[model samples]
Target: MSDTTTTSLLDAITVPAAEGRAIPDAATGETMGHAPVHDVEHLNRAVAAARAAQPAWAALGHAERSAILHRTADEIDAHAEELARIIAQEQGKPLNGPGARFEAGGCAAWIRNAADTALDPEVVFEAPGTRSELHYGPLGVVGAIGPWNWPAMIAIWQIAPALRMGNTVVSKPSEYTPLSVLAVAELMNRHLPEGVLTVVSGGRDVGEGIAAHPDIDKVMFTGSTKTGRAIVKSSAGNLARLTLEMGGNDPGIILPGTDVKAIAENLFWGVFINTGQTCAALKRLYVHDSQYEEVVRTLADMAASMPMGPGLDESSVLGPLSTKQQFDIVSSLVEDARSRGARIVTGGEAAPELGPHFYRATVVADIDDGARLVDEEQFGPAIPVIRYTDVDDAVARANASDQGLGASVWGSDVAEAVAVAQRIEAGTVWINQHGTLNPDVPFGGVKGSGYGMEFGREGLKAVSAPKVITV
Candidate 1:
């Protein structure tokens, strides 16, 4: 639990490999470390090892597993800053703000939630001669495929619940940010029994293998919709129970008469947190005609004032895009919106002086629903503000999207905001806030955003198998 212990833990996993894929620092294009490039065969062995170890883990029962997870949470707290450093270097989220440190803390908080959540057998029915009780048991081994945006936190979201519900886990971290996940798993393995958890740091092949492997009873994935579709296909071979949390183009509606200044900072952070690489970040905004100009101007000023630089910089609130592919996508979408004559309120260019993957925090106004930046999930520090006069039309436009992960409504009237939030077609809706998550709240998506819930007691259920006992 000391600094030296944390350093040794990281060193054990980050030892230079003779032949492994080079991982680059997101802030600078310099090579930071290497991750072992595992293949399908490696995935097979991991799954097999997990399968071999699952029965004994399940035998430990919920109380015992929960106790272990509680200790793991302690370990996470001890190594939080170290984990944050790794996340900052590998994933390009700044140490400050809702970036690396926040993510590292989130991992521990979620684990504690999973451990504390009680899932005792429930008595559903009682008759004159019979009674029915519902119980949740382990599904053996769960394959967790995580994303680059929140490598360590999301991996914990998948792993913690599965472990609490008595299932072993084989996790496949995103290729873009493997070391953070590996480092986290290394700490977790300290408390976990051998083969109970594995981090297979590999590419698409490993992900595909995890989905299709017959031994993996369930697969929990968080990433793009396109990739979610492919996982569905791969999982079909084995009919693996899947929980996919995919892409989201979340919309935020600012009601007329709302105070723009009061909500500006929250709105700005909602859109630009982690440099806006979040799955449920506010991607588009629909402002009532009366407040559109003020909202746009206020957000632009806030975005301009915040520093955007390397993740290691103490003053930086925003960092570069995590990968070149993501950087290109954001650039292309913003360009497409610009070509369509949308007014660039602020930050319309990349910060090449900062880093190769650094795109400036951008806000485009006078844009309609059809603009590529407004329609597609840009997944970067770019937001499009669209003007609308009718509240009904605004609700309709927000609900029209194929993706429905999370949405927010802002207004002075709390009742009115809640009413508007109810109509938004998203898994979770917020009033005067956006993208704020609690470990106790159930989070997931509908439509193309993917199915299955995570967090709270429901999240514990998602990774578990239900059984009915009637007598």
Candidate 2:
């Protein structure tokens, strides 16, 4: 009944910081909590703790480590609701809907799945007198840098594999949404031995410190391509094994004969999930010229129908963009498209009536590949519907970007959609659906989207060093 949004639990449980900085709420623009601004010195200590713990932790061997991971997953599942609320409060996502609870559930599931996945020693070659075996050796310490969007899930994506692969972890979550991640780290640490997992909350410099830390043998990061590039540059000093999941200007192609009405809701959520803050969310939608208007009309109507508000509100389907800077970016891109003759099919302006950073789910029609909305990764709730005459040309346009994160093909005929999806240059290409990720499926990027994979056996390998032993 109160007009104010619910506060984060971390706001009450403030860990002392030498130089604390405030983090604002996404919905109200009110300062929700303060996190300690950790510097290189703080990072060094965390990394040292990781180093001190790695050998003993790794010495526990696969079974013991797996048990601990299972216990950690249990802890996560037990605290799901509380954790989800923390996520909603700090990260500006609906608590009950596919927001905080979904993300928290995902974190728990990823850990459980990681525990079940095996990284068994392989005997590569064997003769009567000689044998060679390949084993995955734990890298001393893994440095994880998680982004603000889906902080808990992405942190688990980074940490679960690292820990399961027998490495100690030191994580630095984006300062804006650090609380949920800090809480995750606490839960994980409780289930493990001391110094095995550490979280240092800070800004850009702390992330850079983690990347450049000599003690950290590997760095797993999920963020912007610009920040990914910076991490690559810094990690070069240590020659650390790096898995970077970066930017995506993902495309969704709607084939000529597809039923617009049938797929509208799926299309709407595919592009607009996480308020379009998703790295793999469809940013550009290529519709057949014949179906363009119908597709646009249906999607726009759906977008306009959804309620936008604070995460705590039960009626709200979409929450505010996680930060003011992101809101500005979305606004600027929409404005640029408008200036270039793109029609605002539905919502475009910020909903000040809702709260700060609450930009309505926007749909832009009559946009070309040249439009900013079509080309750039807006990373917000604004989608451009581009009309394409030829299917080949559409695929070409989709592959023309500097990014190749994810792509989707939609058609009434699943086989035809599959055929077209194969042509798009991206890490993962979907048929009928978009951005549906599985714990066992490997996902990453190509071209300027950055390299290396996450999830599955490959993800386990990314956090490990393969050593060949001959006897």
Candidate 3:
């Protein structure tokens, strides 16, 4: 514990990291990308090791386990920049994306929230002959299915809470972005119990295996709604616990009287940051008639001006779309939108010259409500603007999708904006800013956007189970 680098702590464990090996590029095949390379077989072995080591880990007193969690938080902070770089490489996000900050911050937040905030069992009611109490307990092993867009950050999103509650984890990082997690898992194997947490790397089959495994007590997933449904149906057989943050067609409503330019910047960040790969990215925009043209024009100009290149490059404001599958999805969505009569005011195609998978930041305007681009979770670097006559109508249209994940309201009048925001069916509603996340606030979705919270006190409780005892 005295060694700040976690050096002595790591020295206590038996598993050594894969040494002197070259790392692979998550987005491309040419470079070390970011972190040390690992093998899929190695990841599988580590998780099995964790499963074996979990009973002892679970047997630790809550206080003892909590102290160790704090140590892990410190280790995360010490490696923030390095991990951020790895995340950028592995997830194909811009180095400036909140990955590094989110990784370190989320770990500390989850540890504190889970360990300090979760309720303890106490005698609540007693019969004349009996004493009754209720408390939370850890599930044996958690199977976490994380998306590539947020490899490191999302892993911590699940790991911190699960570990704090004394549950082991067998996390499946995106095949495209596994190293950042491998790094974390390696650190864990060295510092914590060998099987307290592990990473299992493969494709969707690995996900299926974890979901169907009898030993996995719960399944927490962050990805598309279609996949979420499959996970739900498959997991129902075992009556496993489920936490999902699925597809989001989040809407951003620009109400009248807002400074058109300022709100436009917020919209740009909402949709374009992380190259529009976030689950909460503003996929749909509803601007009041008074500000429709201005909002569209301003958003188009800003989006068009964004620099697209490699994320590790200093000048790049946007990076490649992570994997070739994402690149194709973005490209196809853009094409489908244009073919269905959406106006391509800014970017609408892949820029092959940028790299193997770089796509321009796209802003599609004049798209109707029925257009696939306007109503679906694009999950790409594109936002389609739709105009509405009334503020009520804007809210109505924004709420018109099956997915309700995150949304934002922009207006000079905070009271009116709040009233309008209250009507939208989403897990989080921002008054002005969009796509912002905080550790204290809960984040998740409603409807097909999936269920359960991932942060704050609600999140702390969700990853654990309550047990009642009567004597």
Candidate 4:
């Protein structure tokens, strides 16, 4: 075990102590607060601290480590309400409703589950003179780079498993949504040993530094493909183990016999949750030609009925995009599709009155596969509905993306839906549902969606190294 040292205020200082970045309220575009912007030096210090603390932390018994993690989770639960409000203000997910609380609750659940998860040593061979056992051991310091879509929950997703496996962590939250994650670190750090867990908030430079750091043994990141590629290149400096959950252009296929009304509400939330910022949200909908019009009209009516306003407003069901950049991405895709003769059944423009980044829930039909909205991930509150005549062709089209993160098939016939789900090429395939993730289930992507599982025992192993012992 390495020597333990007490952490001081200096350990938490950002590189440019006086310079901070303002955090904008996603719903109102108003200044909520400012997060200290760190630099490469701050990130390097965090990695060094984590590296120094990891040996001692991993030296503790698994049960002892688990207890500390549970205590951190308890602290998180105690502050759920306060955390939820802060998260809503910063990330634009509804507070009184399901958005903020769901993320907060998820953090607690995943942390607790990770605490309980353990890999027992396995006996490999038993002979008169020889025996072997397989073990999963910690990989020292882990670097966690979090995303903005579900700031608190995703950060916990990375931190919990790494800590549970007896590794110290240095995490960096997205600059756009750093407050909630910083708050998570502040509360969690109170229950954790000094240098066990640290959060360095900064822009691209800090992220690159962590990935390229010599001391960080593993890297877990959730973000875009472009950035994930860069991290892969930087991590080559030390060949750090990586788990990346990148971009996804998920598809939801509505079979001809599916009951449109029965699934409308679930379908609406499935696609539009978190204002459609979810990586695995149903980005494109492929419907049978017979039900194309019905699906589009039903979805448009359901979308229009839901009110859009500030996330803190109890009546609003949807909030603005988290940033002006995201708003522009969604707007541009919708515009490109609209120009290509795709009919916008409902919304297709920005809601500047609500906020600078507000975009209405949109449904576009009469679109071919060539449309940008249909081919690419809008990553916002816009979905394209493509008409298909043959089931085989629909499945083929759905699996055509460079991304294979998640896909779903909807139909009244349970057997048929499950069978169809088997054909969609994605890491996770859903039948009559979409993006339903649990801690016990392993989830990841294939192809350009990025690699490595994030949950279940497989995820726990991702943070660990396997060693074989012989006797």
Candidate 5:
């Protein structure tokens, strides 16, 4: 889309307010638009509006709600390009590759899946005279707090199920990328009833209010572990149900004798997708000593070849870091690794020529477990490849982290890979891929990564309360 058209789209959704925050394009640092700065009072008003509208929304029954959800999905499909453009501008993800466009299409697909997934009341217990049926009913208003990494798509992941299960929603988008989410909410509201869905763009106060609001029946949040802990504490007043998808320092293991060349592309995308800002992206790799050199070489070559530039560029698959703060974090981690004698196989520097936030994709080898880059969730365009002599030891090291969001095993022997995957202590374990999600599969984290699941039937249930009736 042209700059004029992009500005027009943002203007259409931008709320006019005396108090607002300027939103900047992630690539160029240009002011894209403004988002109304909502406070706790605005959050309260939004919760009240959602609560007042929820009963009627629930009374519409599953069939009508499902129909409306399907229509909303269609609307999302209609405006997918516009939403993708907004995401590219605000979130620093390229329009091409597995970036803005992929996320936009995912929103529609997930909404449709939520609509079609069967969640009818089921008979849990049956006898001659006694019968019990379990039903899932709306839990009133749902508070959705989304992250900046996948702003629009993750909002849909929270909103779609909540709305599909017959609940009104009040969402708080991350401060860094509120425009992308606001634009999405604008498109969805075209089909949804007034007050049934609201997006309050603000800072930490608004997010805390959403978690602590008494009228809000549940909170769905995706962000950092530190912030997730704060939300957990905030939810204590009313004990609102929470589904938190938090920090993930996922690991990938390459078993002995694996074909490094065949899986190089998948591995590269797994570590570098969205410039590695993804919550579940593979942050560290444990390669067997036999193929460690080959794996490092393959990844470094791929990292050096991918173009890192502005998100709007047609040929740019890799884009800038979403924010300067994130860029600093990634840079610090890599610098620490370099100081500790880790090999910076390809890139270890920033690309200020492209933009203030651009960092070249990096591959670090000869890194061990104690280094900050190997231990922390780097969440940027960098991966540390550690060599291991034994498969069991590798599995043990991968499972040693506090975060257990996702893990992957790569090997020529399918059974061996599956065996290694089974031993990992993570919410989801992939055989040959990493961070690949499907609408039908359940996804979430364990331990410090956060609790509760999101996606498919479990996601539907997470937003609603269950009632058992024995007759």
Candidate 6:
């Protein structure tokens, strides 16, 4: 393999944690690769390099820096296939699964948006000899601690904006899925200056190093709320600027008179797209009692239709969970839901017939608010459905969670659907649809899902040190 040894961080860098670790394909449970568990000593080296690079990168004019970022998009496009393969092997998501290509496309979009729309602070001049200006500048190097879910794509959400704003970065991708980030970093740096972007991989210790680094001017994290809170506490000493995109238990609602069969397709892919291991995947669903049966039947049919296999197989629609812990979590959630008197309408067990690390796309019905599956972020393929007598009740049930990451309200009636959508407490609410993202708009969440936005000018704006000049 072109990547198994050459671009391997183990061969490339020396670290204490790099001693020995096996990287296996999640789909087939085969040892496809290995990578170093980068230690703090290695992390410190990357941080120092980033600190040195940030100043020089920032010294470049905005247009020039933006141009470099734009070029990065082109480089990513050129290397999409290679990156995708690495992502599939290490992360165990399929080659066709949304990996390098999707991520590279997002990088293109974000950098372009940051360079264009996400502006420097506005400059205002009043008629009576009063001048006021707001300008943005990079915050030196940034520390990015990313999760394992969708490694390359989400990491780009941080790296793209930070780079466009001329902030060098030392990002630690989740140890559970480090190969994608390692390959992405290697490929990206080939098109960029050496120290502009660095990827260091390890477990929690490496993450701690990035969070507490004195040279790091800002910190961006995408992971669990528990970890995010700890990051904030650690960042207190340096008071480094922070942005956290945490977990979600996003709701999906179906109202009366809705075309159940038509939406079944969208809902299926939306929830189980990546084995339902998504931040915004439909965890808790509310259906109007009048149409509950139809919706349930439709969803079940759709889930059953999806093809599953080892990633290399063309027939595979769903792959395995990235790690053993996630598999256990999904399995336990199903066992709990079943024990709580929920109906397992479709799937509820590990598909040993499929292979290791594979879990069936589970669906549960007749769930209530108090059920563990109802109000929690499953982050798996299992979805629990609850029926409501009234639209208001459905809306109430949806908004009951402390997490406000994303939500979707569905119906044939646009007016009614949008109205219910307004009542949703999420940061991004879709009408008649589920997950979708672009570089132009701000993306983040409220409450426990964390604070601050990413993507577009909003993301670039976050990396800048806002200065207010008034005369």
TM-score of 4: 0.95
Each prediction's RMSD over C-alphas, in Å, is 1.6, 3.6, 4.1, 3.8, 2.3, 2.8
The deviation in Å at residue 122 for candidate 6 is 0.8
Clashes of each: 0, 0, 1, 0, 0, 2
Instruction: List model 4 lDDT by residue over 73-100, tens digit each.
Output: 9978887877787788889988754588
Give the per-residue lDDT digits (tens) of candidate 3, residues 204-309: 7778777777677889999888889999888977778999999689998888888886666776888886788889988888887787788888988887887776
Q: Considering TM-score, where higher is better, how would the candidates rank from best to worst?
A: 1, 5, 2, 4, 6, 3
- Model 5 backbone overlap count: 0
lDDT of 2 by residue, 356-429 (tens): 88999999999999888888899999999999999999999999999999999999999899888778899999
Q: What local distance difference test score does each model get?
A: 0.91, 0.88, 0.76, 0.88, 0.91, 0.79
Q: Which ranges in model 5 have alpha carbons more than 4 Å from their true place?
A: 1-7, 15-19
**Model 1 stretches with alpha carbons more than 4 Å out:** 1-7
The digit string of per-residue lDDT tens for model 5 on 111-183 reads 9999889898999999999999999999999999999999999999999999999999999999999998888
Total residue pair clashes for candidate 3: 1
Candidate 2: minimum summed lDDT over ten consecutive residues — where?
1-10
Q: What value does the lDDT take at residue 418 in candidate 6?
A: 93
TM-score, one value per model = 0.98, 0.95, 0.88, 0.95, 0.97, 0.94
